[model samples]
Structures are given as C-alpha cells and as structure tokens.
Target: MPNSPLHDWDLAPREAIALQKRLAGQVEREDRLDPVGRIAGVDIGFEQDGAITRAAVVVLAWPPGAEGEFEPTTLEIVEQVVHREPTRMPYVPGLLSFREVPAALAAFERLEVRPELVMVDGQGIAHPRRIGVASHLGLWLDLPTIGVAKSRLCGRHREPGPARGDWTPLVDGPDDEVIGAVLRSRVKVKPIFVSPGHRLTLPTALDWVIRCLGRTKLPEPTRLADRLASRRGR
Candidate 1:
C-alpha cells in the first residue's frame, strides 16, 4: 500500500514551525534498526527553475566498504524512484522540510523496494527545530535515516582532519549539545555533515554513511540520486 499523509502539507511558515516542534520530539535518537541489507539515498531538487519540486530516491545494496577515493567495484543499485510535483510552498529559512518533504514522500511511496536505512541530502536533527528534511522523512516512513548533507544547516563545528574518516562533533545551543558530526569522506575534498534522522544514534549514522562512501565526496547511493535528480554531473 502507498504511504498515507503524515500531516497536512499546505501550511504557513508558523504552522510548519509548530509541526516541526511536534514531530521533533517523536524522532528516536537510539539505534533501533533491523539488519540493514538495502540502503536508500534521497535527493530533493526543483525543475523548470523552481516551478516543480523533484525528488529522487535510489536504493543500493549495503556493506560497501569505506575504501579510499576510488569508486567501489561492487556497488550495486537495486532500485530508484523519482517524483515531481508543483512546488508546494516558498522556501523558508528554518522550515525546509515543509517545502521539500512532500515530494520526497511521494518518491518513497513509489519505490519498489523499501530500504532498511536511508541517507538524505539534507540536515537531520541539526536543524533549528531538530527536524530537517531527513528527520521529517524518517518520521513519515518510520525508517532509520541519516542526514549526509553536503553543508551544515545548523550547529557549529571545528574543522575535521583532512583525511578519509576523521570527523569533529557539530554542536549547538548554550550547553554545546552534540547534534551531528562533520566528516571528511575524501582526503582533500569538502567534508559532509552526518546526523541521525530517526531510530539511530549519531555514531550509528556516521558509521552507515562511512560504509557507503565510494570515490566521490558524496557516497554512491546519494551521488547517483543527485545526478539523477539534477540530470547533471555525477
């Protein structure tokens, strides 16, 4: 069966903020995942210069090792889905999920195989309301998800060591609470932000993303999805 609506999508910024706060408390921060055999990557974008919201989801086999900057030889893609719809709402600074997640959920609903874990190209608990695109999608799908974002949406962090796996904690608030980690997926390329979206801890999120890295700055699953969604460079 297709996924039902998690909440009303047609929302004002204020309503979205309140909904984010309500959903944020529902996100599980502990490792409570089944044995992960398949992983999915999500990429959200726009088409026709913002008239359409496009979402891509790519499912790949798991256990691809964290090798150096070389494409994985055994990376296997099992499924992929793309969903596009009219842009729902204007972009709001702290309410990105409200603008992006509806299409993502549609893409996931169209997927043939349900991935055990998901990696999203956006923030997770690192958002101001602790509910970025990844976290919001996770709540809707009830799946374990990790935010493998190219940039940090919130929190401050020291520079991670310029190596394949070195990472630094990304902290927020007065207490300096650790929300995520900044990771260098490649030796010299830009680092990525890794945060647990749902049903996983921050450390577990980092481990899953590291496990999927292959050659590029973005991991295999996400890289493919981004390329698919953007219809551009790999």
Candidate 2:
C-alpha cells in the first residue's frame, strides 16, 4: 500500500528541510520486502526550459533472463508510464525529492503493473537529510526502492577497483557510518553510488543492483528508464 499523504508539497526550502529530517526517522533501515517478481526503474527529466517536470516508470520482468543469457536490449517492458506537470519546486541542492518527486508519484499511480522492487536514478539515504528522491518515492509508493545515482551527492568513500562489481564503503559522520557503496558497475567507467531507499538493507540494495547491471555503467532498470526519459524530453 502507498503512503497516505505523508506531508505537504507546497512549502519553502526551509520547511522542506525540516520535513526531510522528520521523515528521515521513519525510513526503515532493515530489510522488509517480499519476494520480488517485477522490477521498475524510476527517472525524472525536465522540459520546456525546466518548467515541465517529466517522470518515467518502466516495469520489467524480474530475474531478467535465463542465467547468463540475459539480454538487456530485449528485456520485456511489462508496463511503462510517463507523467508531466509544471515544476512544483525549483531546483534546490540536497532537496531533489521536493523538486522531482511530485510527478514521479503520479507516474507510479498510472502503472498497470506495479513493481515489487524499484531502481531510481537519484540519491537515497546518502543525502544530507537522509532522505533523497528514491527514499521519498519509496515512502510514498510503499515499495522497495534503491538509489542508483550516477554521481555522489553526499558522504565520502575510497576508490573502488577498476573492475565490474568492485565496490568500496561510502561513509559519513565522524564515527564513519556506512551510508552507501561506491560501485564499479562496468569496467572503465566511473563509479555509481548505491544506497537503500526504503524497505531494504544496504547489502540487499547492493546485491540487487549487481543483478540488474547491463553492459553499460547503469543497471538495466534505470538505464532503460533514462533512455525513455531522454527521448520524451526532446
């Protein structure tokens, strides 16, 4: 079940920051997911000179393909939905959910086939407020989500080895708390940051990301969603 109006969307940056702190406490830090059968990719883009926010959700069959016969190019798109609306909140650093998530929730509501697990193209708990776009979306949608960001938003980490699957701990705070993982999704590519969004653990989040990886630096789920978003943005 999805969340029932967690909080208001109309607020100033200061109000939004306060909300993030309150919501951060409710975020589940342990694994609380069911058996996964379908997976979805959630992505956001802009159009009309950043006036229109475009969100995409692409649901794919779980287990991708038979063993090593996996073909990301031919993966079945069980369902796809796109939503666009006037930008609700302007771009605010460390406040991505406030800017991009209103339309994302709308897109998910339009999906005919709901996904059991989701891969989002943004930050999760690796944000300053501990609530990034993926975590925010998961709280609203009530589905397991992982943040698979192309770049680091917060925290620090050691360099991962230059090989597929090599990863290092992304830590924060003076005590060195693990916030996420810096992962080498593909060889000769920059590392991606992986973090638990909701209803999942860090290890489980990392494991699913590795399973969904395609030939590119991104996993199959978010990779396809990114392509779909780019085409629609034009």
Candidate 3:
C-alpha cells in the first residue's frame, strides 16, 4: 500500500497550490543524507483510459567509477493504485508537481530497498518557488533527492561546451547565486536541468547525475523508471 491521500483529478488548482505551500514550509534541510549507497529513480504514467495511474520505481546500486555503468535490475516489488476521480486541474506551467507526486509516492512505497537518494524526472529548487516535484517528495520523505528534468524550467545559463561533461552554472538572478547546473551528460545530446531537490547541494547533485549517466542521455535510474512506467501503461 502507498501513502497517497489525494488523486490527480481530485485536486483543484487553488487547493493544490495551498497544499504545496503548506508542505514547502515543512521541509527539514538539516538532515540531508550523503548518498554513498543505493539510489532510485521514480516516474509515473497515466493510462490512456484516464482512470488508472501506474508508478514505477527502479533501484540501482551506486559507486560506479568513470568506466563503470549502471546495470539496473528490476526489483520485484511493485504496486499500482487507482484514482477514479477525474483530473480537474488543467496543465499549468509551474504547478506540475501536484499532478505527479501522488502516483510517484505510491511507487516509492513499494521499493524493497531504500535508496539513499532519489532522482525524479522533473524540476527541483530551480522552480519559481524553489519547490518542484523533486523538492516536494524530498520534503515528504525527508530523503536527499535531485531533479533531472528533460527540459529547462526556469533560470538562465550559458550553453554547455560541445564536448560531453562540460557544464555551466545556472544562476537564478543577476547576483550569480547558483541554483543548479546545466550539465552536458552526453555529447550531441541536450543538457539536463540538474537541481538539488533536498538536503544536498547543487555541486553534489551534479556529480551524482554525471556519474550515473551510462550509455544513454538520461541517468540509468530515471531511464529505467520511465521505461517501466511507460510500458506498464500500455
């Protein structure tokens, strides 16, 4: 069983925003974990039927060196929950965290191995309020997490170099207080938006994401979770 109390379709825009604001204040930044152990990736997919949500969580052991790669084994532990309520909230630019977190949390509860850190397929503190889906989940679980979004959400930065591994800081404003980094994980591939979700710093988040990049554009955990979620929906 998972710990999700509300469904995606059940929340109104105003109610969801208020709930996020309430949760944002509860974030405990002092107890962040330094992830030297296992790591997990979480993603959610909705069935075309629009009645069911499938959440997938994939765990991969860490500490892979420069040449090492992530060979994630699908854990047998998996769970699915249904939300019969219709999705009332329309797609909004900054409020996506509310749309996805419920299903993500459901999948996370079924993980047999607790990961020291989690990477979500969305934004983190790089968001307008410094609270994206990754940040929201980190606050709820009190776990160190990072947001590895496929597209740029907010902020400005220089384009990374043509070569892989080259990166530039993502500044939140003219003062140059770095909120995250635009990392070139793979050559000729679009850079991923990496931001600290909770407990960890931007530098640490970038290092972990870079290390986890295997033979693909996305990190192994996120890639695997995405695959599973997409497949399960079919």
If both were scored by TM-score, which would come out higher, candidate 1 or candidate 3? 1
Provide TM-scores for the models.
0.92, 0.93, 0.81
Per-residue CA lDDT of model 2 for 124-218, tens digit only, reads 89988789999998998888899999999889899999988999999998888898999998889899999999989999999999888767889
In model 1, where do residues sit more than 4 Å from their true spots? 1-7, 64-71
Better of 1 and 2 by lDDT: 2
What digit string (tens of lDDT, one per residue) describes model 1 on residues 1-234? 134454487788778788888899999999999998898989987889899988988898865543443456466788888888888788877888888888888898888888899998888899987888889889999999888888978899999998798999999999999999999999888899988899899989988787777767887778888988896744
Residue-level lDDT tens digits of model 3 in 1-234? 144465443567777777777776665444368646778888766666655666677776665433453322332222322222233344587788766776676666665668888898898888776788899888877789899998888899999998777888888766766777898878899988898898888878887887777767888778778888777433
lDDT of each: 0.85, 0.86, 0.73
Candidate 3 wrongly placed segments (more than 4 Å): 1-4, 7-10, 25-31, 49-51, 64-90, 174-176, 232-234
Clashing pairs in 2: none
Against the true structure, whose lDDT is highest?
A: 2
Taking every candidate in turn, the Cα RMSD to the unseen true structure, in Å, is 3.0, 3.3, 4.4
Number of residue pairs clashing in candidate 2, backbone atoms closer than 3 angstroms, sequence gap of 3 or more or interchain: 0
